[model samples]
Target: MSILNSWWRALVALIFPPHCPVCDLPLGDEKGPICSPCLASAPLTSDWALRNDTPCDRLSVKGCEVRVVAMLKFHKAPQWRHLIHQFKYHSRWRLAREVGRLYGGKMAGSLFLSDVDWVIPMPLHPLRRMWRGYNQSEELARGIAEQTGLKVETKSVVRVHYTRSQVWRTREERFKNVQDAFRVAHPERLAGCHLLLVDDVLTTGSTMRTCIQAIVDAVPDCRISVAVLADAGGGS
Candidate 1:
C-alpha cells in the first residue's frame, strides 16, 4: 500500500508540479512547498538566536509577562508578505506547515524554548475554522512540535468570540477588538505547565495579549513563551 501510494503521488506530481507559494515558481522535485530561491530569500529575523531581550520584548508590556519570539520581520519584504497572505487567507496548509518547519528548525536549539513543556496554537473561532477548513496556527504548531518534541495542546485555549479583522484597525481599536475574546477551556489541564504559544503573525500584540491573559487567569502558575512566524510592524 505504501509503495502504491508513493507511486501515485509521483505520477500526480508529474502531471501537476508543485510551485513555491511565495514566488509561484515550479518546485519540480523539491520537498517543500517553497522553491529554493524563495526559501533562500525569506526575510528571517535576526533575533532568532537571542535568548533574552528579544525583538519581541515589547509584547511583555501588554498585560502578560510572556516572552516572545518571531521567525520573520514582516515589513518591506514582499516575499514574506505574499507567503503569509497565501498561508493565512488562501488555505495554503502545506505552505504554513513548511514555513513552520523552517522556523522550528532554526529555533530548536534556542535556550529560551528548551524548557517549554507544551505548545499551544492560538485558536480560531469555530465558525472561522469551519470556513477555512483548518487552522494555520495549528498546522504551524504541529511543525514546531515535530522539531522540538513538545506536546501540542490544542483544546486548552480557545477563541470564544469572532472579532472583525484587525488589518486596518488602529492600535487602540485592535486592543479593544480582541477584548474578552479568548477563554481557557481546561484550566486544570494547563496548571503549572510551561507553554509555548504559537501564532501566524504578531501585529500589535493585542490578540496574543488577550490570549495570554486568559491562560494566566486560569492557570496562574503556568508560564508562557510566544512564538510567531512574522512580526508585522505596529505597536512597538
Candidate 2:
C-alpha cells in the first residue's frame, strides 16, 4: 500500500495484465487471472466432496485408507479438458497456480480439508521434469499450500522410474503401467501425518492410486486424501 510499492505494482500490471485461463478474456479489478463468468460457470467437479465413496477406495491397500476429491469435471459437457491441455502441453504454467488458488479458496471453509497437515504433489520422472523446466503438479501444490496454510512437501515422494504415457492405455494397462513407478523418498516426513495428494487432473485414478499405494506402504500410518483440479470420472 505504500506509494512506491503501488507505483511498482501499476508498472508490473501494465507490463503484464491478467487474462482468463479458460476463454482468454482480459481480467478486471486487479482480480488476477480468470474472469467473473468463467469463475462462476467453469465445469467444477466438486461432486466427490459430497459423495461417501470415491475412486481412492478402489486402490485399497492394507494399513492405509485413501480418499479422492476433485475441483472440476474434465470430460463433462462444458469441457475442462481444454484448460488442462493448455496447462499441460502449451506451457501455460500460470494456469497451475491460478487454478490451485481457486481450488484452495473453494475448499477453505470445508470441514474436511481444514485439518490437512501437508500438501504432496504427484511427481514427474526426472527426465520429464528436466524437459519441461517445471512440474505442473508441484506448481499447483505450492499454490494450494500458500492459501491453505498447509506445508507443501515437494520432495517427500518421487518418481522412481519413467513409464509410458497413460493417455492411450486401457484402464488395466494404465494401472499396471504406473505400478511401482513411484516411491516415497522421505517416508519419515509423512509418518503419521495427514497428506493431501495433489495432481492437475485425475483420469482413471490409476496414477494417483499407484502413488498413494507406495506412500502408504512406506509410511503405513499416514492418512491420505486426493485432490485434483479435474477428473474424467470414468470407470473401468
Candidate 3:
C-alpha cells in the first residue's frame, strides 16, 4: 500500500471506527471488518466440509459448481444488512474492500476456495455502475485477489441488462428478474480456467446462477464456484 492509500485508509478508519459487520460495534484494533464475536456468530454453510452441491439445484447451470460459501446469513441479522447496504447504496467503498478481505482471509485455508484460478465478480449494469461510483462486487474481488494471489478479471463478465431489485421479490419473481441479465465478454481467458464467482450477498441465487450460465455458455470448459459475504434466506 502506498502512503496515499495508507493515509486514506487511516482517515476511513478514524471516521467509521472499524465497526463489526454483524454487530455494528467498534473492532478495537482487531484488524478486520468484524469482531471475533460476530465472526464466530455469523452463519456459515460449509464450515469443516466443502459441499459441492448448489444451493438451488433447479437454477444450476453447466460448467460451474455454484457452491455458495457465504460467511454470514442475511436476515434476522440486521447489522449485516446495514453493513452491506452501506457499501452498496451508500458511498462506502472502503467497507467493500474490508468485508472482502475479511471473507477472503476466512477462505484462505478452506478447501472451498482452494482450486480457484480466477476471482470474477458479478458485474453491475452499466447504468447502475455509472450511477454508483464503484462496484461493490469488484471491490470484493480486488480484496480477494490481493489475499489469494489469484487474478481478477473485471471485464470478463458483464451485466447486459438492468433489472429490478430483488430485495422484496419472491423466488419466481427473482428468477424472472435476473434472466438474461449477464453475458461473458471474454471467453478465451475462461475457456479452460477454474473461476470463483464473487458477490456481496446471496439471497435467492438467481443472479449468480444467471451469471454462471452465461459464462458456461461462452466458455464450454470453464469451471466455476460462487462465494459471497452473506447468505440470507433458505433454499432447497
Candidate 4:
C-alpha cells in the first residue's frame, strides 16, 4: 500500500509539478508553497517573542490589552508583498497556511503564546467570503493550530458589514470603515477563553481593533492575543 501511494504521488507530481507561488519557480520536493530563497529573503520583524513590547505597544495605545505579534515586515519587501498578493488574491491558501505554520512553530515555545487556548481568524463578511471562495485568515489560523495544537474557532465571530477596501484609506478612515463591522456569533464558547486572533496582515490595525472590541464586548472575561503574518505599518 505504501509503495502504491508513493507511485501515485510520483505520477501526480510528474503530471503537475508544484510551483512556488511567489517566485513562480518549480518547487521540486520542497515542503512549502514558497521557494527557499523567497523565504530566506523575506523581511522578518524584530523578535517580539524576546522583547515582546514593540508590537504590543501600538495595540496598548488603542486600549487593547492584548499581546500582539507579527511575523514579517510588510512594507519595503517586494518578495513578501508578492507572497501576500498570491495568498490573498490568487487563492493560494496553502501558501498562507505554510507561512502560518512556520510562524506558529516559532511562537509555540514563546512565553506569551504557548498558553493560548483558541486560535480565531479574523472573520470576513459573508458576501465577501463568498466572492473570495475562502477566508485567508482562517487558512492561516488552521496552520497555526497545526503547529501549536490549538483549537480553531471559525464560526464564533462574523463580519456583519461589507466595508470598503482599506488599501487607500487614511488611518482615521480605516478606523471608521471597520467600526462595528464584527460581531460575536457564539459568546458562550469564547467566554473566559484565551484567544489568539490571527490575520493575514496588519496595516493601520483599525480592523483588528474593531474585531477585538467586538469580541471583548461579547465575552468580557476573554483574554485575547493577536498574531498576523505581516505588519505593514511596522507597529509601534
Question: Which of the numbered candidates is closest to the native, going by highest TM-score?
Answer: 1
Q: For each candidate in the order shown, give its overall lDDT on alpha carbons.
A: 0.82, 0.77, 0.77, 0.81
lDDT of 3 by residue, 1-236 (tens): 69999999889878977666557777897866668887777665454156555444634675355556666756646666878888898787878987787677767766766778889888999899889988999999888777767789888888988997888899889888888998888898787987888888777777787788888888889777777787665664
Q: Tens digit of lDDT per residue, candidate 4, span 132-164?
A: 998899988998889878899998999999998
> Candidate 1 lDDT, tens digit per residue, 38-77?
7787778755587854335555543347677778866746
Q: Decide which is better by TM-score, 1 or 2.
A: 1
By TM-score, the candidates rank as: 1, 4, 2, 3
| Residue 78 local lDDT, model 1 | 61
Ranking of all predicted structures according to lDDT, beginning with the best and ending with the worst: 1, 4, 2, 3
Candidate 1 versus truth, CA RMSD in Å, comes to 2.7
Q: Name the runs in model 2 displaced over 4 angstroms.
A: 1-19, 24-31, 47-55, 75-77
Q: Which candidate is the best by lDDT?
A: 1
Candidate 3 shows a clash count of 0
Clashing pairs in 4: none
Model 1 scores a TM of 0.88
Report lDDT (Cα) of residue 29, candidate 4. 74
Whole-model lDDT, candidate 3?
Answer: 0.77
Residues 114-233, model 2: lDDT tens digits: 668889889999999988878888888888877777888878899988997888999899988988999888888889898888898777777888888899889988988888786665
Q: Per-residue error at 67 for model 4, in Å?
A: 1.7
